[model samples]
Target: MALAGQPNVGKSTVFNLLTGLSQHVGNWPGKTVERKEGTYSHNGISVDIVDLPGTYSLTANSAEEVIARDHIIKERPDVVVAVIDASSMERNLYLVAELLSLQTPVIVAVNMMDVADQQGLKIEPEVLEAALGVPVVPMTATNNRGIRELVEAVDELTRDEATYEPKRPEIREDHRAVLEELEHLVAAHVPQPYPSDWVSLKLLEGDDEIMRMMEDRLPQETWEQVHEILKEHEDAVLAVASGRYDWVGRMTRAALVRPGVGQITLTERLDRWATHPLWGLLVLAGILGLVFLLTYSLGAPLQGLLETYVIEASARLAASALAGGPSWLTSLIVDGIIGGAGMVVTFIPILIIFFAMMGLLEDVGYMSRAGYVMDRFMHLMGLHGKSFLPLFLGFGCSVPAVMGTRVIDSRAGRLLTTMLVPLVPCTARMVVLAFITPIFFGAAAPLVAWSLVGLNLLVLAVAGVVINRIAFGGERAAFIMELPLYHKPNWQTIGILIWQRSLAFFKRAGTVILVVSVVLWGLSALPTGDIETSFLAGAGRLLAPLGALMGLSWQMMVALLTSFVAKENAIASLGVLYGAGSEAGLAETLPTIMSPAAALSFLVVQMLFIPCVATVVSIFNETKSWRWTLFNVLFLLLVSFGIGILVYQVANVVS
Candidate 1:
C-alpha cells in the first residue's frame, strides 16, 4: 500500500507500528530518493506496505511532489492507506481528493485519535467515509488501536468487491465538452468509474505529472482537446483552490460534531507550564543537567574499571609474548594493538551513558519539547523547527546529525543546517574536552566544555544571520511541528537503546579508532624510536610556532595536530606525551605541556576542528559536493585557531 498523506500527519508513526520499524520517524526521508517497503501478516494474509514520502498535493510542481505522485501512479499498490490526522481533517482531505482522482482503492486511517481525544476534537468516521466514498477507521497507531480494522478495510476495498462510485460535484457548464470526453474516453482507457469532475479539477490545477501520464497513451486528437480544456480552465490552481476548500467545508459541516463547553484536557493544562518560556527553559536545563551528570559520573567508574583491566591484561600478555616473539614484533602486537584497543574500549562507558540519556529524552518525548523551545530561534537561523533532531544528534556525532537533514523540506535549509552541524561540540568533543580541560580547570571542565559549546552556538548564530542575508536571502519561514505529549521514559526501551548505541561504540573501538590508534602509536614509535625525534615530532614543532601563537608548548602542539584526524587522539596523544600511569611524577610530566591558557586554547582548537571520518562522510553524502566539504573542514579549522589565538593572547595580555 502507498502511505499517502500531508507532512507530519502520523504517516511514519503508522509505518513504524505496522511494519514494526522506526526510521528516524520524521516527515521526510534524507537525500536518497527511493521508496521503502515492508511486509507483514494480517488475518492470515500477507500484506505489503509502501511508505511513500509525504506530500501536500500531487501537482508535480516540486521535485518531491513529482516523486510522490510518480510512485503512486507507476508502482500501483494493492491498496492506498491514506493516513490522515483526525485533528487536521480539513487540510488533509485535499490529498485524499487528489488520490481519489486516480480511482485507487483507499482505506482512510484517521490516525492519532488518542491525541485528538485528549484535545477534545471528535470526528464522525462514518460520515467522513460516506462523504469521501471510502471506509474510515479511527486509529491510534501508538497504542496499535484500530490497526486490524484499517487492514481489513483495505483488504475489502482492494478486493474490488466494494466498488468505488465517483462523487464529482458540480462544475461550470462551459468546461463540459472536454470533461465529458475525459469521462468517456479516459474512462475507457483507465477502465474505472473515476469521477469526471475530479479529473476536470486536476486539469484545472495544471497538474503536469498526471497530464504527462495521460499524454502518450491517449490519441492525438484527445491530446489536442486536453490542451484546449486546460486553456479553457485557464487558472486550474485557482479553480481547484476555490473548489477544494468549499468541498472540505461541506464534508466536515455535515459530518463533524462538537460538544459544547468541553472541559480542558490533561494536555492543555500541562501545556501551560510546559510551554512557559522561563519554566520550559528551566525544565529543559534541569533535564540537560541530569543528562550531563549521568554521562560522566555514571560512565566514569565503568571506564576506570575497563581501563584497569585492559592495562593489567596487556602487561601480562606482553610479558608472556616476550618468551616466543621478536622484540619489535612483540612491541607491535602488545603495546601498540592492546594500548590502542584499550583507549577506545574505555570509551564504552561514555557511549552507554550518552546514548542512554539521549534515548530516554527522545523516547519519553522531551526531545520534541526541546525542539519546541528552540523552534522560534531556529526560524531566525533560517531553519525549520524540525532541524533540531539532527542538531541534537550532532551533540553525539555529526554523522547522524548530517544524516538527519533528510527530514528538512528545503535544500537551502538542509545545506545551511548541515554545514553548521559539525561546528557543534559533539559528545566526541566530550572525550577530548573532559580529559584535558580538567587538568587545570578541574570542576570547571563542564563549565569550559559548555562554554566551548556556547562559542560554537555563537558562531553558528552569527553564521546563520550572515548566510541568511547573503545565501538564503528571503523572509523568515515557519514549519508545522507538533510537539508530542510528554510521558515518563521507558526503562526497557532505554535499556535496549543503550545496548544499541553501546554496540556502535564497540564497533568503532574495534575498527575505526583501533586502526587509527595503532597508526598513531606507530607514528609516535618510528624515526629513532623517540617521540621528540619522530616524523610527527618534526610536524609537531612546525605546529609549535603556531602553537606559541595560541600560547601552547611543543607537546600540546603535537597533541593538537594528532587531534585533526580524530578528537580522542588528542587525549591518547597527551597520555603518551606525559606518560599515562605516572602520578608519582605528576608535576614533572604535566607542567611541561604548558600553562592554563595554552591548555584551554588546545581544548578550543580540538573542539572546533573537523569531526571524525564518519562526520566528514556524512557531509559528503548530504552536500554531494567536495568543495563544500573542504570549506567545512577549513572553515572550522580557521574558527578553531582564530578563537584559540585570540583567547590566549587576551589572557596573556591581561595578566
Candidate 2:
C-alpha cells in the first residue's frame, strides 16, 4: 500500500503510528526526494507501506510531483490510500481527482476529523464514499481515531480480486471531446501499463514530460496531428482544471455542512501579520531575539555552574587519582581526553535551549511562516523561499541544515543553499564569540555580538549573489510551501526533538571530538614537554605571516587552526596555549596579551572560518561532490582572513 497526500495533512503522523520503529529512509531512485517504507502487522496480516511525497497536485511541474506520479504509475501498488485534510476538503480533493484519473484502486482516508469538527464543519463519510466510489474512512490520525477502519478497508480491497474502476471527474464537453480523440490515438501508439486516458489528459494539460514521451514514441504524422489538436485547444488546460474544481465543489456541498460560510478562523487572522512584508520581519526578529535571550540568560549561568562545580572538580579529582601514574598518561587523560571533550560538553545547556526553542517554533508551525516571510529576501539571494528553513537552522547547527536541503526540489537551489549555510554562524561559533566579546568590549559585549551577527548575514548575502552568478545559472524554481495552522505545542513532541538533536551532538562529541582532541593534545605535548616546541605550534608558526596580516598572534593562530576540528576546540586551544585553566581565566588573560583591535579581529576570523569537521562531512554527504566541498573550505578561508584584516585595520585606526 502507498500513502499519498498534500502537505500538512497529518500523513506523516499516520505513517509513524503504523510503522513505529520498523521503517527506513532513503532517497528515491535517481531523485533527492526521500523515500520512506515500513512494514507492520495489522490484524495478524503483515503489510508493507510506502509513503509518497506530499504534493499539492500530481502535475509534473516539480521533481516531487514527477516522482510521486511515476511511482504510482510504474510501481502499480496494490492500493493507493489518499490522505485528505477534513478541514479543507475541497483543496485536498484536487489531488484525489488526479489520482482517480489514473484508474488505480484508491481509498480516501479523511484525516483530522477532530480539527474539522472544531471548525464547525460536519462531514458525511458514507455520502462521500457513495459519491467518489471509494472507501472513505474518517480519521483523526494524530489521535489514531479511525486507523483500524482504514486498515480493514485496505485489507478488504487487497484481498478481494474484483476489478475496481475509480470514478473520475468529468471535464467540459469540448475538453471531453478532445480528450476522447487523444485517448484513442494514445492507446494505439503507447504500450500497455501507460494509462492512455491519463496520458491523453496530461497531454491536454501540456505536461512537458508526457509531451516528450509522446514525441519520442509516436510517428511524425501522428505527432503533428496531436500537436495541431493541442495547439487548437490551448484553453483546454484551464477548462479541465476548472471542471475538476467544479466536481469537487459539488461533492463537498453534497457531503459537508458548514455552520458559517467564509468565516475567517483565528489562524487566518494571525497569518495576516505573520506573513506581511514588514510586520512579519519584525515578528521574526523579536522571536529570534527572545530565543537568544532565553538561551544566554538561562543557559549561561547553568553552563558556568557545570564548568565550576562539575567539570573542574572532576578534573582535579582525576589528577589526584592519577598522581602515581606515568606523567604522559596523566596529561593525556586529564588534558587531552577530559579537557578537550569536556569543553564541548559544557555548551550543551545553551544548545539544548536553542534546540528546544527551535523545536517549539517548528511544532507550533511558525517556522513555515518564517520561511514564507523570507521568500522575497531569498529570491534576492537567488534562492527559493523553502531554502530559508535550512539556513535558519544553521544558527542552531550546520549538519542538519545541510541535510535539510533535501526538501528543495531543484539541484542548483540545494547546492547554492548548502554553500551558504556554513556562513550562518552556528551555535558553537556563537560560543566562541560569547567567550571573547565580553573580555574586549565590557558592557558593550551584546552590541558587539549583534554587530558580528549582522556582519555574518551581510557576508552571506553577498556570497550568495556571487556564488549564484558564477555557478548556478538557471531559472529560479518556484517555492510553494504549506503554512500549517498554529496550535498549542505538544511538550512530548518538543522533548523528543530536543533529545534526538542532543543525542546526535553528544555522539559527535564522543567520537570525532574525542579522537581529534587526543591527536591535538599529542601534537601540543610532544618531545621536551613544551607547547612552544610542539608540532602543533610549529604548524601555527608557518601560518604566522597570514595571522599577522589580520593582527592575530601566533597563539591565536594555533587556536584558529585547532578550530577546524571543532569550533569549541578554539577555546580549548586558548586555555592550553595561555595556561589558563578555565574560560573565565582565559577571558581575563586574553585582553592583557593582545590589543583590542587584534582581539576583535580574532573573533571575526572565528565567526567566518571554515566549518568544523562534522559539517564538512555533512556537506560532502549531501552534495556528494568533493569539488564543492573543497571549494567551500578554501573560499571560506580567504573570506574569513579578508574580513578579519579589514576589521583589524579599521579598529586600529579608530582606536
Best by lDDT: 2
Across residues 1-655, which tens digit of lDDT does each residue of candidate 1 receive? 7888888888877887777752323333454655667776776777777787788977776767767766666666677888988877778887777776664677788998877776677788888778877778899887889887877787777677457664533344444455566556565444223344555556556766556656766788877877776776676466556555667778778666655545755666666766677777677778778876887688778777887887657757776968577766666666666665555666667666777778888887777777777667787777776677787667766665787788778888888888889877776577667666666777887898778778888888877777767778855676566868777778999999888756754664357555765676677778677887888888888777788898877777787767654566666677667775443354345656577787777777777776766567668878998988888888778888998999888877876
Per-residue lDDT of candidate 2, residues 1-655 (tens digit):
8999999999998899888999999999988889999988977888999999999999998998998889899989888999999999999999999898875699999999999999899999999988888889999988889988988898888888384555678777767878898887777887667798888888999999999999999999999999999999998899789878987988898899987736877788889899999999899889988987898799888888888887778788889999999988888888887777666677788879988998999999999898889888998888888888888778877877887788788889999999999999988899889888888899999999999989999999999888888888735667567889999999999999999988876785457667877888899888767899999899999999998987887889999998987787899889978999877898889888899899889989999999987788889988999999999999999999999999999999999
In model 1, the worst 10-residue window by lDDT is 22-31
- lDDT of every model, 2 decimals: 0.72, 0.88
Report how far residue 232 has shifted in candidate 2, in Å: 11
TM-score per candidate? 0.64, 0.67
> Where in model 1 is the C-alpha error above 4 Å?
1-202, 205-238, 250-255, 259-264, 272-282, 319-324, 397-415, 431-450, 464-478, 482-495, 565-568, 578-593, 612-626
Model 2, total clashes: 0
Where does candidate 2 have its weakest 10-residue lDDT segment?
A: 159-168
RMSD of 2: 12.1
